[model samples]
Target: MTCKRALTAYPELLSRTVAAPSWVMPGTVRDNAIFLSGEVDEVGLCFFETAACLAYGENDLPEHLADLPLGWHVHLPGDLPWCDGGAEAAVPALRLMDKVAFLGAHRAVLHPPVGFADGAARLVAFVRAWEAAGRNPEDLCLENIRGEDLTGLWRTLCDLGCKVCLDMGHVLSYGQYGLLSLPGLSGRTSMLHANAPGPGGRHLSLDTLDGAGCGVGRAMCALLPDDAVVMVEVFDWEGVRRSLPLLETWFAAQR
Candidate 1:
């Protein structure tokens, strides 16, 4: 559905894809997003928030938005092993997801470390950690990314038994992005990231999408079932504002 309309749904669905690069942790960014999105459901966050949560060793999410109905998008922390050289951190990461799931949150948009394949090997470590903490496999969402060396990221996901969060812009980063397909997908996947492009794939703010990088969006929509979450991962408010029409068109096609 359209971003605007997704917000209008039952229990209230909001957008704002939180991301975590290797330099930062995912939970720290998530806490910031929660604090921000608490103001307006769609809070923008970086990928480091998860690590922040783990490092803090808090059993629950930051209580910033606890009073308000909560919705969270948690990017997985770290790269490679996901917890760096420390396997101890896995317990906390999975613990964090379980706590969020307990909140009955709208959904946690997981940016699966696009390591290699979205399959079993890469995901196995994370999956075991999550399950050990009592998290349902379905509660997590593995995400996709742009770039060539995405080894077994997807394969690890399948083995882990989790769904995906498809970022539209990352897929469209290349012309051949259209060639990729969303295979073996169920309606369980949700959330997205995109931005307006001025031309030459410039990642404009979220408020403006002139249909610059839209091919992957089409590919994702075709791959997914109806009623999935679409987080327009726009650069800023302006880009998000402009991309609405494009999302509307995409959502309309689903009908």
Candidate 2:
């Protein structure tokens, strides 16, 4: 079945960092806002990199963002190893969530740490901390990462009453390794990180979808509810531009 959902573009679309030997200047939040003003329905901000900008008294840009008519979403930093750092990690995430709440963001996408041995317990503690702080658990979305055994992680999130941010590219990568069976997870999904997966887990433009990636993308779109949000998660302007049409076509076909 086809569902109607809001489409958003990642901030990387306005500007992104290039690798060594290449000097490509990234755009500021203001520049990005101006570029995407009339382009999409919402913008996905990377909190890991922009948290400093939202610190006390640095509200000029965020104030402008609040004035915009578009929706807002936050992507938490993946660098914080919640599983290993215990309270240390959870604290920062909580702080960021506070900022997300302040911005009135619809949701915040989060990633489980890389080597989370005690994933379940760690997540429980983290969620408890979030709850104690009076943050809305529904606004926190746990995303599936590459090469991780997300089954237990998913269960932990579900138990805590949190939602999911299904990253299509990561799912496709997992499927490649025969680890892609998530039966009831989609029902709890509130957002989607839309992108096509390439070799070595690279995020590619939706227009670059190979046969398998295309099928996965279509399946995801079909599964999401009408109120779900889809963020084009590619990292460059060209990729975002190319992916938008493909996403529109997919959404149209769904109807």
Q: What's the C-alpha lDDT at position 145 in model 1?
A: 54
Q: Each model's TM-score, in the order given?
A: 0.64, 0.79
Q: How many pairs of residues collide in each model?
A: 53, 0
> Candidate 2 on 1-255: residue-level lDDT in tens?
111121334332222111110001166655565455555556677665434534634432456666655567777777675645555666777666566555576567877666657767777777777778777778788888865646767666777888877788887767632324566765787887788888776678888887777877877776776667777777676676677666665666665
Worst 10 residues of 1 by lDDT: 17-26
Least accurate stretch of 10 residues (summed lDDT) in model 2?
16-25
Best of the candidates, TM-score: 2
Candidate 1 C-alpha error for residue 199, in Å? 11
Candidate 1 lDDT by residue in tens digits, 87-166: 34455565555555534553444544443443344356666766776666776766555443123455556666776666
Candidate 2 regions exceeding 4 Å error are 1-25, 49-62, 100-102, 176-181, 199-201
**Residue pairs with clashing backbones, model 2:** none
Off by over 4 Å in 1: 1-64, 78-89, 98-103, 106-120, 147-155, 174-179, 186-188, 196-203, 206-212
